[model samples]
Target: MNNTYITSFDYQVPIDKIPIAELRQVFIDDFSDHVDDLESPKFQNITLDEIEAVSVYQNYNPGTEVISVIEKVLTDKSDGRELDLIIDYSVVSKLENGLSIGNKIQEQLNARNALVLSVGNGGCLSFMLALKTAQAFMQANDQYKNVLLFSEDHVIGNRYNPGLNVLGDGASAILLQSETDSTMQLVDVECYNMGRLNPVLGVRHDLKGNFKYKEFENKIQPLHYKVIYDLFNKVLRNNSLKIEDIDLVLYQNMSHNDYVGLKSALQLSEDQLHYGKMKGHGHVFGSDIIINMCHSTEQGKLEKAKNIVAISSGAGFSWAVSLIKN
Candidate 1:
């Protein structure tokens, strides 16, 4: 195993200051004329109460959000630090024009000496992929010092669909270094992608085809649980550990029911899970795990924890689980 650690992380939600209620009000006002459309089952039976509970941001741009997080992380924490590589995980090729967001971030951060790259398109599993890639990079090159992984998503275009889970606009930054002195160590990572299920969710016309949203929704939850259960076992077995060895588990915040379904399927107790605040943060792509980890640390929940597991599933039918030794 190569020496790799998650030294530091920070996240930013530009519209986090706004209350969920206000966000919901805006939606109500915009879609007031189509009450029937909003009431449809396709919208997940969304109500004003549900909107007020789930976190969401209306107009923030993900590209701008990503740049802000990167600037803050480098200024406040990574000052004078040199990065060997920077990876941006996003859904689109470029936020604006033809220039990649990763390249723009690299230039703005004065990381000209570092290699810049981008991967994934609205895939929540991108963060795990980024970490895995960083680990592999460190193992292949002793000179590799630090790798910056940045991810962000904003409510854009049809993403405001009333029938989908509340999507928030935010960005998160994680710094992975070759040093072993950090508090969080990357123990192991496991990822699986089921290409056949790609059309079950997301906006890609080619991937989605003529699939009925209602039919897909009915089967998606069980698939989520099954994949998570299998990945959980695979990660534990690979690390020579068991369920009892995991002190805490974090997952991508989809909705209230999502957390409950996973907990029931996995047979995990409340003490072993951390997802209560998800209703307040909604789903911010792959940043949910990092956000949960940060909150848990702030709340002193990780004080007694030795090992933590972070799991994420993307709309592209990809699932990833990573174990961290604290």
Candidate 2:
């Protein structure tokens, strides 16, 4: 694993609809009649201009989405080689009978010979944990040739959680190999878990079955800024790098205000951060950073960038940062 590389990656988000307005209307027409109640401030304050569009899946399950993303990656980038392991980072795992989502994905991929492992409950940071786990597996076992990391989440059952940004449906896949000629290379990774705020930002079902978005905003938002700032500093220090050395910082795709808050906290300029994906794609749970990176590379924004940092924060009170060099 001396020359481990992310050879190629691809992401899939259903684009049958455009702009957030259309999606909202579709939801309103199909689910509820009280439009004002659905658009209440307690749910979310995002405007149409702030969020251009989001992908939605009405008939696909998480396991099927995972398999679809894997097929896309293999068909478009891979060399028709079999994978050694498949690691899934789905926060909401849909279980049928007794089988888990990971097992269903493995069975669908026909990778019965490959090892399957799932990491859940880490929210947006789950994929970072999966990446770290894949690296460890490769380093520990020389026989493991390649590993695949997949992440996908959607707003199916918990659509009323207003503490979070507007939810979307999307999936991303990354292929890790021992030797490849890709420009992007994984340099270092770090993660921290602060469980003090675990219950502040998830779906709440009490007697009224109402959401606690206001409480989450009041209690967790301030802590989020501090935690992100500290994690960024820690990763920079641990890697012997400075803020100026980072060509691009790809943080999670939240609202515009959240991005501004982070930029102000870090005192970074617009050129130092890449967050244009948020307006068009919104937040896709664990796949936000990966989707941003892929789109940035495709748009040629990363051609001259030498070092990039990808960071994410999850509801479980976990933060992760990964340093990539090109």
Candidate 3:
């Protein structure tokens, strides 16, 4: 049950949009109507739709591309180690019909279950997908010796939303299996969702009102932090752990300000919090948390700790916290 080590990781973003930071900021600006203080009167005059149009992330399908890179990455990283099971997800926007993503992967990988966490009308589909993936992995009879947890989201094509284009599509595949043969151990997991809200914070649509994205601000939406704090507290409390018990805090890829607020709330030290290639890769949607964990290991950050916690949050207005012990 011990001696797990994350061997390697592989990542690829379309060279066309290699610099995704610019796109991300554009989307952030488009959604900036919610900013505390608006400097330009022109922004006030612009409609939300106009702003959304500018923020869209385009090109590159993270789902299919993620799988290709992940299969190659995991296999290379495993270095001939035999896997007992694999858990994977190629999540795309509901507007994009993610079911096909799963089908595409099923063609390549030998997986027992294919779960899809559709956002419905909520924006935090990533959080929901992660929650589902963790729950399924934990509940399984441990019959599978190796598990591959994968996530991918692509922005272009379906016009998921104006912000979708700004989000560079990417995928991450993690090999999870017996602690004896595994690289990283899954210690604990927690999840919380904003039960009361309509979940869809942002909604966009075509001129015909077909469907775009109904937007919601995570900052203004207390539900984002509320569920996050609640889930984190529960995970620690149930495990009889204090904030200091965590060696490192791996947060979901989020805005810098949001990260600060979370660190303050969790009382985490700067050294204790880690984010890997997040800005460089843009948020890999649902793969953010897992990718960070893998990236941390690949970069030798996790080598120092025997215990770590991974916290993730997304638009379904949800929060998830998972702990691992090395």
Candidate 4:
């Protein structure tokens, strides 16, 4: 079951990246006075530098551009690798108004006609869906020597809610192959979902007419680490492995608090975790997993690991995990 470690994983992003936006502007029919006011120092004195420093609001969704970045990562190192994609339902679900996210992705990758080997919904279980997709695709396509696994998502599904700060707009691509190289190896995977907790994290509409974030300040919501730690232990127990055997623990960065709790719950030292810091990247939705992997590669932090486990949890009350040997 040992193969070459994940040799190279890369990513790209558009320069003109736009963030999800919200604005409160009242329209004025008699615009002359309003225009005069807008032209005053209150508005005119504002410099582009200051504006740039201030985060811009995103009114449009980022889809193909993000997927394009994922494809870039795949094709860059895909010379001898197979391609598999684990797409989160949120990327293309009608409820989120993302019906075209998947097809647009296929078009960006020139894979519109490619066989849909497997498809599943993570419901907030994005990580599990991804791993399940990888397992199924590998089993179904033995001849598929090189595989490309990818996932992309936007923050629009959460209605641009500020509470979902950890969620960002991004995409990820991992090139897999039958032969081993210097890259990280895909050892095994374990996944589960807590659908009962689905109501705690989601997008809902209120009288204001826009979607609102649900669970931003719930202290108990972070108890998800207990759920994740239990599932992780279950996976290790099933495979006769121990947490100490794991060299690195890559978990989704929900927030600083989640990371701290997960670290204590998992009994992991600080070095065992990847860059768990919550930057302004704004909770990249489902792309955080690969994003962290790519960051590790860039920082040369992935070495000295015999085994590494990746864990991801999302709002659908879902969880996905995988064990990789480096």
lDDT of each: 0.69, 0.71, 0.51, 0.51
What lDDT does candidate 1 reach at residue 64? 62
Best by TM-score: 2
The candidate, 1 or 3, that scores higher on lDDT is: 1
* Cα lDDT of model 2 by residue, 52-164, tens digit: 77777767755776676778777645542467888887665456562447677677767766788887667778888888888888888876667788876655533323325
TM-score list, all predictions: 0.83, 0.84, 0.69, 0.70
- Enumerate residue pairs that collide in model 2: none
Candidate 1 lDDT over residue span 1-326, tens digit each:
45778877878765444456565566566544433334356465543234344434555443666776676666644642488889887643356564557876777777877888776643777888887888888888887778888876654422233444555667788888876457788878888887777666652422212334554566675587888899999999998998988889888776666677778877888988887455556667768777887888888876568989888887567888889988
lDDT tens readout by residue for model 4, 220-247: 2566667778888987887789877887
Model 2 Cα displacement at 109 (Å)?
Answer: 3.0
TM-score of candidate 2 relative to the true fold: 0.84
Model number with the top lDDT = 2
**Clash count per candidate:** 3, 0, 32, 31
